[model samples]
Target: MRSLVLEDFGRLTLHHEEEPHPPAGCVAVAVAYSGICGTDIHGYTGSNGRRRSGQVMGHEASGVVLSTAADVVGVSIGDRVVINPLVGCGACGACLRGQAQQCPDQSVIGVTPSSPGAYADVVIVPAGNLVALPAALSLRLAALVEPLAVAVHAIELGRPQRGEVVAVLGGGPIGQSVVLALSVLEPQARVLISEPNADRRRLCTDLGALPFDPGSTGAGAPTDLVIDAVGHPATYAAALSTTRRGSRTVVIGLHSQQVTIDAFALTTGERSLHGSYCYTPTDLRRAVDVLTTRPQQAATLVSTVVSPEESAATFDWLASPAPPAGKVLICFTDTNEPVAAHR
Candidate 1:
C-alpha cells in the first residue's frame, strides 16, 4: 500500500506502507477519495504542531469498507461510507451530554495518534464514525460531508432566521460550506460572502451568495448575522463591525494565532459572538444527504484532485497563503489520474 505522510513541518511524501487490518470494533476502509483539508495544511506548516516524522495526513474522506468486525451490525464489508473524524471518550461530561467534540478526552483522527488517517491505501476508523454513503452520491462528492457538517453546526449555533442578512467572512472550504448550508436551509435569507480571492469570490456568487471584497468595503450594509470563517485577527474585527446591534455572530474557523476583538463592541451593542466547533452525528447525517442529493453543487465545490504521488506538490500549492479555491480532493485509488490533468 502507498500512503502520503507528513514527514515533518513543511514536508510531505508518498511512501509504500502496509495496509491496516480491522480491530475488534474497528473497520478498514480502502480509501477512494480523501480531501486535503486546511487543518492538514496547518499541520504541514507547523501551525498545528511539528509533524511526528511519519504521520498520515488526511481526515476529510470517503471510501469503501474493505472489512469490518462482526460486532458492527448496521454497516458491512464493501459498504461505501464517509468518516466523521472526531473520536471522543464516551465517559466524559461533555460526551455524556452528547457533545463529543468538546469532551476533554476527545481527539481527532488525523491530528492525534490514537487513530491513523485516510491518506493511506487502507485506513482504520472506529465503526461509530462511519456513515453509509447514499447510492446517488459520487465518491468524490461524498468526501465533503465533514466540512459541510462543520458549516451546518455553525448555522445551528447562530440560529439565523429567514429573511435576515448574513455575511460569511472567508472563501475557504469551511466558508463555502457555511454559505451552502445556510442558503439551502434558509432560502429567503440574504447571504453575502467576504472573500479576497477572485476565483473563490466567483464560486461564492455561483453558489447564490453575494460576494463582497472585505478589503474594499466592510459590507457597507448592516447584517443580521456574521460568520467568521477566517478567524484571523483582521477578520475578527470585521465580523464585529459587519453585524447590526443585537445581531449574532458565529466564529467557526480555527485560529491558532492570537486574535483581538474589541470588548467595547460586544458590550455596547448587545452583540453576541458564539464559537462553533465540530458537529454531532445528526449534522453528519444531514451533510451526507445533501452531498448525495445535490451532485451539481458538490462538483462545483471541489476545485482540484490529485493522485497519491502528486499529493505532495498539490498539497504544497493548497497550503500556500492564497489557495485557488476551497476544496481540493486527493484520490488514493490506484487510477494514476490527476483531477485536472486533462485541463
Candidate 2:
C-alpha cells in the first residue's frame, strides 16, 4: 500500500507500506478520497502540536470496505462508508455521558501518531466509527462529512435563534461550512462572514453569506451570535466586540496565541462564550443527512481534487500566505475510474 507520511514540519513523503488487516470488531477500508483539512496543514507546518512526524495524517475520508472482521456487525464487506476519526476510551466519564468528543482519553485518528490515518491506500478502524453513505452520495463529497460535523457541533453550541443575525469570523473551509450549516439549520437567520481574502469572501457570498473585510467593516450593530472559526487573537477579539449584549459566541478554531479580553465589559454585557470541539455521533449522522440531501451546496465547497502523489505539492501550496480558498480532495484511486460503484 502507498501512504503519505509527514517526514517533518513542512515536509511530506510518499512511502510504500504493508497493507493493514482488520482487527476484531473492526474493518479495513480501501480509501477512495481523502480531504486535505486545515488541521492537516497546521500539522504539516508544526503550528498545531497534536500531530507529529512519521504519522499518516488525514481523517476526512470516504471509501469502500475491503474486508471486515467476523465480529463486526451492521457494516459488512463492500459497504461504502465515511470514517469518523475520533476514537474515545469507551469507559471514560465523557464517553459514558455520550460525549465521546470530549473524552479525556480521546485519540483522533490522523492526529495521534499511534493511529495511522486515511492518507493511504488502506486504513483500519473500529466498525463503530464507520457511517454508511447513501447510495446517491459520491465518495469525494462524503469525505467532507467530518468537517461538516464540526460545523454542526459549533452551531449546536452557539444555539442561534430564528430571525437573528449570525456572524462567522474566517472564511476558510470550516468557516464556510459554518455558514452553510447556518443556512440549513436556521434558514431565517442572516449569515455574515468576515474574511480577509477576496477569493474566500467571494466564495462566502456565493454560499449565501454576506462577506465583509473585518479591517474595513466599521463598528456597526452587533450581531446576535458570532462564531470565531479562525481561532486567532485578532479574530477572537473581533468575535467578542461584534457580538451583541446577551448573545453567544462560539470558538472552534485551534490557535496557540494568547488573547486578552475586557473582563469588565464581558461581565456587564451578560454575554456567553463557548469553545466547541469535535462532534458527537449524532452530529456526524446529521452531517451525513445534510450532505446527502444538499449535494449541490456541499459540492460547491470542494475547490479541487488531487492525487496522493500530488498531495505534498498541495500541502506546500496550502502553506503559502494566501492559498486557494476551498476544500482540496485527494483521490487515492485512479482518477478515470470510480473506486466504489454507487448503488
Candidate 3:
C-alpha cells in the first residue's frame, strides 16, 4: 500500500506500508480521496512535524469501507464514507455539553495524538467517525466534508440571522466554505469577503459575495458579523475593529501567538469575539447533508483534482499564496467513487 509520511519537517515522502486492518470498534477504509488542508501544511512546514515525526499527514478524506471489526456498528463494508477527524471520548464534560472539540482527551487524525491518517492506501478509524456518504456524491468532493464541517461549526458559533451583513476574511478552502454555508443559510444576508488573491476574489463573487482586498483597501463598511478565517495575530485587530458594535466576530482560524485586542472597545460596545474550533457530529451531519443533497452546488466549489502523486505538490502550492478558484482534491486514480470536481 502507498502512504504519505511526514518523514520530517518540510518533507513528505510516499512509501510502501502494510495494509491496515480494523481493530475492535474500528473500520478499515480504502481511501479514495483526501484534501490537503492548512493544518496539514502547517505540520509539513512548522514545528509540528519536527516534534512529532513520521505522522501520517491527512485528515480531510473520503473512502470506501473495506472491512469492519466485529464491534463496529452502524456502517457496513462497501459503504462510501467520509472520515470525521476528531477522535474524542464521548463521556467527557465537554462531550456531554456538545463541545467535543474541547474534550480534554481528544485526539485528531493526522496530528500528534491519532494513528496514521487518510494519506494512505488504507487507514483505520473508529467506526463512529465514519459518516456514510450519499451514493451520488463523488469521493473527491466528499473528502471536503471535514473542512466544510469546520466552516459549519464556525457559522454555528456565529449564529447570524438572515439579511445581516457578514464578512469573511481569507479565501482559502475553509474561508470559502464559510462563504458558501452563510449564503446557503441566509440567502438575503449581504456576504462580503476580504481576500487579497484575485482568483479567490473571483471565487467570492461567483459565490455571491462582494470582494474587498484587505491589503489594498479598508474592509468595506462595518459588517454585522465578521468571520476571521485568517486568524493570524497581525490581522486580529483589524478584524475586530471592522465589526459593527454589538455584533459578533467569530475566530475560526488558528493563530500561533498571543493576539492583542481592544478589550476596552469590546467592553464599551458590548461586542463579542468567539473562537470556533473543530466540529461535532451534528456539524458533520449537516455538512454531509448539504454536500450530498446539493451535488450541483458542491461541484461548483470543487476546483482541482489530483492523484496521490500530486498531493505533495498541491500542498506546496496551497502553502504559498496562489490564486485559488476552489478546493483542491487528491483522488485515487482507479476508483469509480465520486470526485467532487467537474469532469
Candidate 4:
C-alpha cells in the first residue's frame, strides 16, 4: 500500500506501507478517489495546528469495500461507498443528542493523527461510517459526499426560506458546495457569493449564484442568511454585519484569527449565529441523494483531478496564493474511465 505522508510543514512524501486489515465492526476500503479538502491545505501550511508530521491527511473519499468485519452488517464486500471521516463515541452527551460531530472524543480519520486517511490505496473505517453509494453515482463524484454534507449541514442550520436572500462568504470547495446545496434546498431563494478571486466568482455565477467581490462591494446589504465559509476575521465581521435583523448566520470556515462583533447590534436585532461542524449521518445521506439526482450540478464543482503521483505538487500549489479554483480530486487507480468535469 502507498500513502502520502506529511513529512513536515509544507512537505509531503510518498511512502509504501502494509495494507491494513479491518478491525471488529469496521471495514477496509480500497480507496479509489480522494478529494483534497481545504483543511488538508491548512494542514500542509501548518495553519490548522492539529495535523502533525508523518500524518496521512485526507477525509473526503470514495472507495470499494475490500472486506468487512464479522460484526459489520449493513456494509458488504465489493460495495461502493463514500467515507464519512468523523467518528464519535456513541455514549457521549453530544452523540446522545444526535450531534455526534460535537462529541468531545470525536476522531476524524484524515484530520486526527492516530487514524490514517484515505490518501492511500486502502483505509479502514467503522462500517457505520460508510454511506453506500447508488449505482448511478460514480466513484470520483462519490468522493464529494463528505464536503457536500458539510454544506448541507450548514444550510440546515441557516434554514433559508423561500424568497429569502442568502449570502455565502467564500468560493472554495466547501463554499461552492454551499452554493450548490442552497440552490437545491432553496431554489426560490436568491443566492449571493462573495469571493475575491475572479475565477471562483465566475464559477459561482455559473452555478446560479450571484458573485460579489468583497473588496469592491460589501456583502450585499444585510441578507436574510449569511454563511461565512471563509472563516477569516474579515469574513466573520462581514457575516455579522451583513445579516439582517432577526436573521441567521452560519460559520463553517476554519480559521484561527480572533473575531469581534458589535454586541449592541447582536442584542438589539435578535439575530442568531451558529457554528457548524461536520455533518451527521442524516446529512451525509442527503448529500448522496443530491449528488445522485443532480450529478451535473455536482460535477461542475470538480475543477481538477490528478493522480496520486501528482498529489504532492497539487498540495504545494494549493498552499500557494490564488491556487486554481474548485475541488482537486486524487485518483488512486490508474484507469481510463471518464470522470465528470466543469471545465
* Clashes per model (N, Cα, C within 3 A): 0, 0, 3, 0
Which wins on lDDT, candidate 1 or candidate 3?
A: 1
Q: Model 1 off-target regions past 4 Å?
A: 213-218, 334-343
Candidate numbers sorted by TM-score from highest down: 2, 4, 1, 3
User: Candidate 3 — what's its lDDT?
Assistant: 0.78
Which pairs clash in the backbone of model 3? Answer: 138-338, 139-338, 141-340
lDDT of 2 by residue, 130-234 (tens): 998888888888999999999999999999898998899989999988888887888898888988888988888888998654556574567889898978888
What TM-score does each of the candidates earn?
0.93, 0.95, 0.91, 0.94
Which ten residues in a row are the worst by lDDT in model 4? Answer: 334-343
Off by over 4 Å in 3: 47-51, 213-221, 321-325, 337-343
Over the full model, what C-alpha lDDT does candidate 1 score relative to the true structure?
0.81
Query: Global lDDT for candidate 4?
Result: 0.86
Q: lDDT by residue for model 3 over 1-343, one digit each (tens)?
A: 8988777777777888677777798888888888877777777787333225677878888888888887766877778888987888889898888777999888887774347888888778888888887777777778888888998999988888877888898877788888777766667889988777777777777878898754545556677888899888755776667777898988888755467788887888788989988898889988887777656766777788877787677767776756357777777535754323210
Give stretches of model 4 more than 4 Å off: 213-221, 334-343
Best by TM-score: 2
lDDT against the true structure, each candidate? 0.81, 0.87, 0.78, 0.86
Residue 201 lDDT in candidate 4: 84
Cα displacement (angstroms), candidate 4, residue 45, comes to: 1.7
Worst 10 residues of 1 by lDDT: 334-343
lDDT of 4 by residue, 1-343 (tens): 8999999999898898888888898988888899998888989989878899998999999988888777888776778889989999989898888788999999999899999999998898998889898889999889899999999999999999999999999988889999888878889999998988888888888889997655455535668998989787888777667778898989999774577777777779998879999999999999998888789988988989988889889998989886888999998864344222110
